[model samples]
Target: MTIWEMLAVFAAGIGAGTINTIVGSGTLITFPVLLATGLPPVTATVSNALGLIPGSVSGAIGYRAELAGQRPRVLRLAVAAAIGGLCGAVLLTVLPPTAFETIVPVLVALALVLVVLQPRITRAVQRRRDRDGRTATPGDRGGPLLFAGLLLASVYGGYFTAAQGIVYLSLMGILLDDTLQRLNAAKNVLAAVVNSVAALFFVFAAHFDWTAVALIAVGSTIGGQLGARIGRRLPPQVLRVLIVVIGSAAILQLLTR
Candidate 1:
């Protein structure tokens, strides 16, 4: 790749890592850059997935404070994410790319809607909990419904890798009783699990552009830390708006390209 192209990928990686940490749509930033840089679709997807692993891990670490009491939650969700990710990776290798194209845009749109309505969803959950005279404890387990939703989201993350964070946030916001920042921290861990599991398969079975991977790894790691710092300070409404806007952009990108 040209130096300029490498620079662009690196820049995208930074933005992606930041966004992934804050909200969950970083792939939307980096994947198109890879495509523009001349990688074929599948190769770009594989390389992008591998490249973002470090950023995801870094983002998770950056949110370690929020993650402190969520070990059981993370562990349970990780299982679903790992299995779903493996299934999605296998599908990516075996099925035609067009197989998922039609559905992805719809998923992005749905995620956007959920993000926009998150405040209402949270309020409703709060009311329901109050009616039941239940107080939210730190050890709240998400149960089977959340597991199913997360598994489906992980499958989507494995296959497409765009806007999966928004999906996770939407599910977690409604299903899990916690602050958005805490749920976001959990989102990063789950996303990392899905990406890491898929990356493991891609590393063995798929071709990649290592330069792209390296550039993104470095850039996204930095971005992840930056995002965690900024994201933790933003008001919930502002963060939700940002997520909706980015999710809309992801939908537009997918529909147009």
Candidate 2:
């Protein structure tokens, strides 16, 4: 890669890390940049998953204060995430490259819809809970439905990442009684687990570009810190709009390519 190309990938990494920390879908930024750099689709996906590990962990650490008193809930959900992530990682390796290429745009489109609808979904869930006379406590682990939804999301995260965080946040918002920041903190932890597990699987089963990994890791690590600082303060609508614009761009690129 040229120096310029390397810089672009690094910058994308930073954007992805920050966005992932804020609302998820960092892959929409990094994946397209990696593709533009001429990396193959599967290689880009594997490398992106491996590279974002540090950033995910950093984001979680930055949210340590919000994570307080959420240990049991986080750990319980983590088991489901780990299991589903492993399954998704296996699916990636078992399928041919063409399958990944064909499915990615569809997945990205679905992710964008979820991102766009997240606010409405939250409000609807809240209303339903109120109507049903159901209340969520901080200690609530979100029951079986939440567990099942998270498992599916983790599977998708393991496969392609992208807006995995948004899926997580939406599910938690509906099922758990917690502040957005606290749910975001938990999202980071789940993302970290899914990425780490999938990356580990790729290490033994798939091809990787170590240069891409290194560049993204360093850049995302820095972005993670930046995200934590601004995420809470940033308006939700702004983040949603940003994600929609970038995600739409990614979808267009994938289809046009």
Candidate 3:
């Protein structure tokens, strides 16, 4: 790639990483930019997956505080996620891409709806928690349901990972505690394992656009740092609004692309 093109791609990577760290739609940005640059769809998909792997790692690392008491839980769930991710990656290699393509519109629509309603839903849940007059226990997280949901989410991630964070959040609510921030932390680590294991598969078995991956990696790693800083400083309301707006835009762009 020429220097200018490299700059553009790397900039997109930074944007993608920031978005991924904030809302989990980084793939929507990076994939289209790569496809527009003339990379084949599958190649872009694979390379973008590889590129985002580091961002996921950094995001998880950035959530170390929330993860302090959840090591055993995270490890147990990680086993399920690793196996599911491997299965999903194998399916990605075998299934007709069209089968999964048909779900993109529906997935995008759901993600948009989630973005719109999550705040209201969270508020209602918070009210319920307050009324119950009990301190929220993080241990109440539903491990089995979470494991199952991770399997389903991984299938989608393996096929086409765009706005997957919403899916994880959606599922987290079902089986986890009432705290949004804690759920968000779990979402990050789970996503990291999913992307990393699948990227490992593509690295060993598939052709990758290393130039694009490298550019995205460098930019996204920097973006991840900024995102973590912002996450530390921002209010929950500000974060919610930003996540919804960007997530909505990302899903819309993915459908059109």
- On TM-score, the leading prediction is 1
Q: Sort the candidates on TM-score, descending order.
A: 1, 3, 2
| lDDT by residue (tens digit), candidate 2, 47-122 | 9999999999988988888899999999999998998899889988888756655766776677667767767776
Reference-based TM-score, model 1: 0.96
Write the residue-wise lDDT of candidate 1 on 1-257 in tens digits.
Answer: 99999999999999999999999789988988999999999999999999999999999999999999899999999999999898889889999988988899898898788777777887897898899998787667678998999999899889878888999888888777788889899999999999999999999998999999999999999999999999989988888898888888888888998
- Candidate 2 residue 58 C-alpha distance from true site, Å: 1.0
Best by lDDT: 1
**Sliding window of 10 residues with minimal summed lDDT for model 3:** 173-182
Comparing candidate 1 with candidate 2, which one achieves the higher TM-score?
1
**Candidate 1 ranges with C-alpha deviation above 4 Å:** none
lDDT of 2 at 43: 95
Pairs with steric clashes in candidate 1: none
Model 3 segments beyond 4 Å from truth?
111-136
